[model samples]
Target: MRTLEALATGTPLVASDYGLEGLSVDSPGTPLGAMRANDVDEYVYAVGRLFQDEKLQEKLSNNGRALIENEYAWEQMTQRYEQVLLDTCSKYLVESQE
Candidate 1:
């Protein structure tokens, strides 16, 4: 989350996919930096890629921020949770009636 947030902020970030499970970032052995056993190489390469290729990094950073801001806002997230909980409880009540 932090790495993604950093990326979203246009701040330099390095991340291993392990910490950010389920979110696959296609770049290094990890997502951004040192997470692999030979992470040093992957890390250097990933960061270097960002420095060397400004456009790609900018795209990722903007995309990341847009994603979180639009899709993962706490209000929206909690609404999803509330809907799920309400549905589950409703189902439980219906089944209990039987």
Candidate 2:
């Protein structure tokens, strides 16, 4: 939730892999929305790099905000959840009629 908030606000991120688990941010073949770091040294390096690199920061900020708008916004999430429930109900009805 916190991560989503940051992304929604277009804030650049330096988060641990575990902190971003299950998110599409660092998925294979996708652009990263946050810098991934797992240790203190890595975190420090990532933060420093992000701070020093304005282009990287802007890229991350835009990507993160776009990700949230496309995938995690309330409208998008509600639609996905509604579809899941509808599919489940339809499957159950078909099975019960069999």
User: Of the candidates shown, which would achieve the greatest lDDT relative to the real structure?
Assistant: 2
- Per-residue alpha-carbon lDDT of model 1 for 1-98, expressed as tens digits? 67556645755455665654565444445233222223788888877877888776766666556656665678878999999999999999999999
After aligning candidate 1 to the native by TM-score, how far in Å is the CA of 93 from where it should be? 0.6
Error of 1 at 50 (Å): 0.8
Badly placed stretches (over 4 Å) of model 1 are: 7-13, 24-38
Q: How accurate is candidate 2 locally (lDDT)?
A: 0.90
Q: What is the lDDT of residue 27 in candidate 2?
A: 79
- On the 0 to 100 scale, the lDDT of residue 8 in model 2 is 90
For residues 49-98, write the lDDT of model 2, one tens digit per residue.
Answer: 99899999999999999999999988999999999999999999999999
Off by over 4 Å in 2: none
Model 2 alpha-carbon miss at residue 71, Å: 0.6
- Which RMSD does model 1 reach against the true structure? 4.8
TM-score of 1: 0.68
